[model samples]
Target chain A: MKPVEIIDIDVSYGAKKILEAITFHADAGEILGIIGPNGSGKTTLLKAMSRVVARDSGEIRLDSRNLDTLGYRELARQVAVVPQDISIGFDYTVRDIVMMGRHPYIGRLASETLRDVEICDHAMHLTNVAHLTGMSIHDISGGERQRVLIARALAQEPKILLLDEATSNLDVSHQVEILNIIRDLTGKITVVSVFHDLNLAAYYCDRLLLLKDRKVYATGTPEEVLTYENIREIFQMETLVKPHPLTGRPYILPVYTHQSGVGTNRRVHVVCGGGTGSDILQLLHAAGFTVTCGILNVLDTDYGTAMHLGLPCVAEPPFHGITPESLSGLRECLDDADAIVVTAMPIGRGNLDNLRVLLDYRTKPIILYSRNSNSPMEDYTGGEAAAVLADLETRGALRVEEAEELLARLSQGYSGRS
Target chain B: MRRTAFITIPALACTLLVSVACAAALGPTGISPGSLLSLPNAWTIIWDVRLPRVIAAALVGCALAVAGTAMQGLFRNPMADPHIIGTSSGGALGATIAIVLFAGAGRPVFAFAGAMAATFAVYFISRKRGKIPVETLLLSGIALSTLLAALLSFLMYTAGRSLHQIMFWLMGGLWNVSWDDVIVALPILVGCAGIYLFARDVNILSLSEEDATHLGVNVEGLKRILLVLSALVAGIAVAVAGSIGFIGLITPHVMRLIVGPDHRLLFPAAALAGAILLVWSDTLTRTFTNDMPVGIITACFGAPFFIYLLRSRMKT
Candidate 1:
């Protein structure tokens, strides 16, 4: 049997619905993360599994035993919850709080046994809170308190552990530290947690269950569930998803849609190479411009970005000269453009045609763009690329530094053309 | 010693024993150890008057303290106490009705019923979806207590000759306590031990009701049991000695500071200390103040201490 499973559950508070038709299962000893935007019933779903909230209609089974059939203490022996940072009103010692976790096993009218003490000590040691056991819980830091709560849960020796955004209140480093401790406990304890930070969920969870507006939008491996299209559809935001270079896990970066109106429906074909065009490409795209780029090597960083943004671009094979086919593609992009923006990129023999071609578009408005005043694009073509650029400048091409200046000039609609 | 359970429980137990003996000997009549051998009526005075009153006072104090500790833990609010939450008013109202209608027969039964009703009313009113905010509970307690007090006053006004009896019960004292009343108050021990069984559960509950439930505590079951036990004991205390205020509220809070919030240690410590406190309060009032109601003494200290708690809590 699976460790836990919820079958077609519906939950509501009074007449208002919180979760509907929710169904999922966790493997024996893997981290299953529940992720969604706020109000997506992520926490409510966890509550149902823990039996904290009554399901309107559904069946939750733990180890094939119906959840409702288990007694409270029996269920507690199987599942433990580490909640978000909570305020502890009384000043209990760290050991005292952890010892309460053994409550389910200890019968009423009986005190904790020596075996219980040993278990509590072991739990504190595992959570790295053994040294702080004698300290009052109120005197400890927030991170320390969270670890104590985890230690308390561990003291239960549970088969399943649940966390409700257990580290959302901590700083990034603390969150990572707590999650690292949790990650180490996975094989021994089947873990399920609600996560507010998607990247953290992606990095840590073995499988992710994505929720959108009270329904399971997707559930699978992180790569399968956290796709660019799925995110846009659910959260209405654009993102760039790539495999992490080291871990090979899918990492996501957001692509903005700021809609500045400076370049709405206006095409600006960037003449850039060697990653110089990356920032300009995103900026133009975000500010409502029809951004395009051209006549570059396929292996270039800018080309990868254009592919991610789905921008139209013309490219030649890596380390090859621009061929007639790619040159015609760049010419067509230029002819259809409202203006052209060129960054100070390294020019070389392989793609010198990029600048030479810009010389042909005399009447099209061109802005020689640089991110900073200090570094112009490096001259690798022995002054030949410089000569081409000077000739273009004489024909009414303007040189502007800074993205703000670029946006300002573009918003003017380039009346200087022709 | 550091107020650990190992040292504090025995030490407080010893103190309570010595306090009870000393209080029983040193009444207004001045029956010293030597006088006890000489005076003819000293045995009668000690056995019939002082001993029962002292035992009843100690039991009543213990009952209030245990009930207070349970309320604070169950609500996860340090300020929750039986008297503050209107349980005492309910008991007093019931006792007054007993005096008016049944000529004071079956007073404890009436008081228990009234206290139980008020406890549930306040609990259900303040609670929302298993969580109770501190302000809502306190405010509702105040509202219900005021309403109960108004009813109690109307009963007293219509009571005519029984008005003096109602007034004496409201002020709360151990003036006429006897062996029969001692037998009546003995069940406070059972109620306290029942609460003690859930000490570990209350410790978990002090975090949150949901947290307690997650840990395998049947939270709703524990809540009902605690409410019934608190009402039984507080109602018993009110029947025995009228509505003694603040012994419950002050004792647990003070003991928690010394012995920590672990209900295991807190229960015993508060029980002993509360007994000791009310024993002394009763001793002083009868010895020096000519038997002013013991409730006056506790409230004088308890209300100011409660204000100080509020002030310090606000500063934090």
Candidate 2:
């Protein structure tokens, strides 16, 4: 059964509608992440669930019971909320702060029971703050304070826990550590947290609810909700979404659009293979050149980089020699180019056709990047590929050893042309 | 800290006992312990005058100190006190009005009513939506207190013949208090007991109202109850002693430094410390000059200590 259900909730403050018709349910024993841009009412929605802020219209049910009808103590016993930030006025000890979470259970004229102390101790241990019990709250770092607050919430021992940007103040490693702790909390208590970092949410949350324009934009697993198109629409920003190498979950890299150079209108065709052209492609792309890379094997790392960058590419099947069809595709990419960049990839019999294709494009403005001397011994084609490269250089191709000089020479050529 | 409390409570009790004995002995006509046992006149002087005054001073001190602690916790501000929040000024104004009009019995009733009115007004004015923000509460208290002080000055200026009596009472001395004055302290004791019962809730409330509410405290209800109780205690103390200053403000803070911010220990400790402070201040006044008001002695010492605290707080 769902432990928390919010249905058709509308929240407004002084006629400002912060959230409208918000509806979702947290499944038992799952981590649900609420994600949205600033002012999308993610924190407001969490506060409404915690009853810190009242909803204008709607029903919130905890374990099929109406939230409004539950007494404050009863609600606290079932759900605990870790606020975004707290500024304590006095020097309360860490243990003092955490033990306050047991306020709902302890009665007047009664001290903390042995069981209450045990729960508090277990919470402190879980948050890795057991040793800081005697320390003042002001003496700790921001990350440690956040853990203490989470420990305070854990001391409540509720069936559901709500966090409102609990890790926002933490550094990257602490962010991961806190999220991992919360991730472990799932299956024991349903965890619902509002996250500012999409990657951390994607990594930790079992399901995500995306808020946009004060409403539920989408809700699903990370793979479904964190699509590039959805992010582009909701956040109004361009990003590349790919599977994380370690976790295979969706990871987002914001595409940097701050382009500056003379190549805004220029197109460059990169002739590279075996990952040699990957750096050149990125440099040229970042320099605002409309770049096309050709004759890379379909499964080559450079080919994958090009695909990830959303650049047009000419490709062949993995482990296959260059064919007439691929060479023809490279010739077409070479045809529309203002310049050509040939990276210093080792030539073998399998890619000897790439050299032949470059020879055909000798009349185009070509820049060759070779960090080593153009020696025949570097060729596996019995000097045939080197001879072709020499012929292409004699045909007025510029030779450069670095991508920076390549970009400089291209900008110079483009300026001269203009 | 527990060891400190264990040592401090009994130590303060012993100090209070010695101070009360010394205060009961050092009146205008000094009563030696031997003479008090032998002479009937010395016994009459001790019983009829000094004994009631000392008991009244202790009760009034305990009431004001406990009220101050509660006010500080309720407002979540260390600087909060009964005097600064206009409760004392309101009581003083009520007593001055009674002296100018009905003279004798109207003072306590009017003073209590006025103090309750001022406290509720501050509470109501500071409230926004459903919660009382600390900044607004403090600002409203200062504003209302200033206004009440102005009204009090106007009353003092208008009093033609009873002005001397009004001034002496406003200066705050326990010299004229009788056993009937001590009888008025019973309700203040009950109010303080009510405040102590909700001490845990007050601790949670001091953190933040939102936190207290989430932790199952009916924050609004608790605030209302504590505010009324604090006002009742402050009003009774002011009615009986005529606006004794600084015992409410300094005692709780000094006790907090000794025992920490936990109100369970701070409350009782502050009560004992306050009783000791006022009993000694009254004793010092009596020993120095028979006519000197106890409020003058307290303010002379308290004002400097208050400045020192403010300066030290600024350094931090």
Candidate 3:
């Protein structure tokens, strides 16, 4: 199959040009993701590609045929679109809704044949929504409804599928699950989707099309397109680009700095648990300390909250416990630190060794706060765990009453606080 | 959320049947229910006079509702009515001209002519080069209706002694309905039903013009057919009964609230509901007082309901 080419397309609504001089080609079987901020004409571009929006002067071609020459039925046979908003107030069953996709194939007064029903069944099964066949489209869940829409598009059996923010309202698992299905469809069908989640786009799309000011800002593989400089230029955000450990995809981490007379003076490092280290990270910043957090996985709420607050955090893959690499990364952070705060966290088999990293650094005073029974890190002081805790206690790590007491001691020039 | 379609259909049918029976029962001279069936002439009179009028009422009701539903979908607007596309004004203008120019001639033919003309005019004015601006279609229809209303008023003024007859026609009534009028309207109503059988396609058109076009519907052709069919029904209804108010505009809206937006069910249900509503309204006018017109009765009920809908929509 030949590539879909958009050549020097310019689209304007009234006097304002929404898209300006766009040129590109999307090959068959390529999963291309378009990313841009609001009002950047991502939707307008999609509309142009579908030949729904009139361009000022340009040509869009599919398999060497100018899109303008192709009839609507012919276009429908090749491209099926799943819009972001499906405003259906009609009383159509899920099956009926999906069957509407076969409209281009069915005769005007003809009913669906056995083959049409089979195709619809296959589409529903692929979307895992056959159970909703008898249900009204309005009566289903948003996630389920979204899947049904996908199923409807799939039933069209098009060579190219266009999805505009398909996973916007879905939950985390649903988002990942839907994107996986879309990814798996890449080799069989050309896919173009608009995504707001940068990480998701990085993980799924073979190539990223970043639109800036109605122009194609950059287009390449995730690694080339997701660089820190390009993101700062296109998205207008200052962030750090780091590589994922497993997939090695580039992930973004934002940095936020506060200006204070105190911050200019000192710097502190925290080894904390259950995200209790957040306050110390904040206070240290308010008091002019350069702080960094580490070893927390991507799913940890504290890690997310930290990122939202614009802290420089080093997070690991979340599991039942921390890995050796996480322990080493935490130790490296501890070594570079002027002071260390070891907050009371549940000593599980995964992270018991995390606390043990404080053992190697003997010179720095380690502030150990008593674990409240209600605290998450309170459980599982085992044979090895007990020995580790005893050894730390014997080493004269300051046993503190509360986080505030530790802060007070730090203010008095002792060492650090958790 | 759960709907009982079977029960709803029968309940509406029963109401329509009862309303028709009552209308026949309460004429200038009170006719006995038993006597109605006994006399063969009485049966002919009821079927010919009362039944045609009732069927006309029902068919007109359905036509207006279906047209209204189609217009709403075509414009992707909620408050749109069947007549908003200048069909009624055009039809009325056509009927008015035929009454003035070819008085006592076949009024239905002229009325249909004027209606089709007005529909085409509105269609052209709204179309720029080749593209139909949905917003422009609405604004142009409003402008045309206002212009035609002014012309209609001028014609009424020059009509002089004929004004009384013209005024009655303007206000609308089914008093003079006969088998001939039914004969005239049957084909139009049948045509409307045939057009409405394509209601499933109209559902797709309601989403977006682009979506409709891409889905293999001839968007422009479908629009033209729907508009012409709606005008025919409206024109024939007006010619048979004269400017009957509210049934065309109100019935479809009420049906939508119950049945949702699927036009397949909505069109037929609205037709039945409109038929029932108008029949009962006509019955009330004939039984309670001979002084008022059927249009007046419909307006009396429709205006407040329309206001209520507008107010509620605003709150949402």
Candidate 4:
């Protein structure tokens, strides 16, 4: 059993103080999750525990030994730290890199022993990177590289493992795969990981430490530390907490904005593609207009941007063609709207029904661009579409040249153009 | 891997042998390659004249490449060139003072002294604000190199009759290399390589000073050893080969691209590659037309590749 303790430790990079008077302790055979926003000193605290980052004032102790007093090899044997940014920038093969973890175990004149090879091989197999042992590090995908890094640490055979935001760049499935591995290793090895995802921490970590403004805000079991009030205070985001369906741990649903002052009047449905609604949604929301978007995919950079902007955007899985269910969802969002604005995102086969829906909503003012007809969907521009759009333009539908013009026209406090 | 290693080792050996043969065959009066192998005077000339020059070139090449590779690893930057930290110019200034002011008396000793002094100065300056900032290393290197280059030029302008000899030395020629020059330069080169070869302890040192110390590496001591070794090798090399360029910078870089950035592999690969590249460069300088300074041939080929790499990195 290993005991890790941080006693009022403070850390600073140059003049900028990153962590302040942080005190915590982890019992043997426990998993500790540190959760915070970007640049919030979560990684810094882990580094300090691993003795990778020097603490300015307080002492970090491991198994009753002062951290600073231990030699590198001694520390390497006890605490294996997977750094937040593991950049294998060269052409070393996966196996070769994993063997670097054995650096502390071998003597100067001696080659790697059979036991070292066995440890590394076991780590590779456990991490599921044995198939990629011969591949150069530069040639592997980011997810595969993350596994290799974890394998390297495992090869060290440390009693305590420190991972700093180790799964941030991975996809959801890979993230779950890594978290499960960390979970399975918990009783065998003490695990500490800096995490940004509260749900993941709640799922895997027995205890959670929340950092705020470079100080430890709270620390306890996941249910205690990951509450709505604590998360609202630490992350500066209001959230609704409920039991997770599977694990029954507290799951947080973000409460974006209070609707009291913001108008619920003049609700508008947006047909957004290629990130076009980002500005329009923001501008409309600022003008007290309620807006919802559809025909966007989750993996698009735009979806994240829209989520950041707190828009109720309907998203499909990436590369999956827009289904009838999504089209129906878009129609339902449009049914309540007084008007619609079509931003000049490229239209294609996946989203031609959005433009067709616009044609059916003849009373709604349709704004098209001159250069916007270059969509990949022929239905959007070919056939009798040109003449139909021309008739619509002459009758009531308007055409705008710029995004700013579209926003200004939409937010004139009323839908009078139609 | 064994095949590559065998092929490379023999190729280096063959190149060294051929360079010695060619340099021996051509002199004040031409001696053919076959005739030199047979005659006793030609054999002595070969040993006394061409052998030392060839050995000097190979040793200096290995030394400069090892130093350059170590510096690049320390910096974690691929674009780092030899003399980016001003060691070469400092060594040049030292050699110039020894040649022009001291009149080639105690030249190698004084050059080594100047080189060490310049290195310490650069180190102290880089470490001043408690961190060895990469920008500080690069900028200060440029500043010191320019300053030393100006001082060297001043020494050149004031050297009344010895200006021509100093200029030729500065331009890097192996024409006048002798057994004594070989004896003086080879030990320093070999010693530096040996010390660097024992630098597995330093392999764990981070690209940054702070990280290295935290990793339990004696950062100050390692930096001092590295800078001193680089200067010793460079000072001896400049003392022998004048200011031969590119082998120090290019050989290390090419080696890094082939073997990973791990210093254990990088250092030795650089030394071997440098030995091969310079021996061939000297051979080219000998056979291409006139017995030109090997520096001219290296820079002509290496500069374009360097520029192309820089542009490509920028594009990426």
Number of the top candidate by DockQ? 1
lDDT of 4 by residue, A190-239 (tens): 99888888888888898988888899889999989987668776778756
TM-score of chain B of each: 0.96, 0.91, 0.86, 0.84
Return the DockQ of model 3: 0.27
lDDT by residue (B1-316, candidate 3, tens digit) is 2265546667777877787677677665567878876776887767767778777777667666766777676656655564566777777777777878787587877777777788788778877755455568768878987787678878867875366555555567778877787787786667667777667678778766766765656677888888777777878877777766667668777777676666766777777788888777777787678747887888888778767866876796
Give DockQ for candidates 1 onward, in order: 0.69, 0.64, 0.27, 0.10
Clashing pairs in 4: none
Predicted model with the maximum TM-score: 1
Candidate 2 displacement at residue B61 in angstroms:
1.3
* Candidate scoring better on DockQ of 1 and 2: 1
Q: Which lDDT value does model 2 have at A355? A: 71
Give the lowest summed-lDDT range of ten residues in model 2 chain A: A370-379
- Candidate 4 predicts chain B with a TM-score of 0.84
Better of 2 and 3 by lDDT: 2
The CAPRI category of model 2 is: medium
Top lDDT hit: 1
Tens digits of per-residue lDDT for model 2 on B1-316? 3448777888999999998898999967877778877787897778888888898898888888998899888887776778767788788777777767776566777887788889888878987876566568768988987787778777767866466556564668887878888888668878888899988888788888888877888887888888778878888888888777778889988888788777778888988898999898988888787757888988898878777866776797
Candidate 1 vs candidate 4: which has greater DockQ? 1
Q: What's model 1's TM-score? A: 0.96
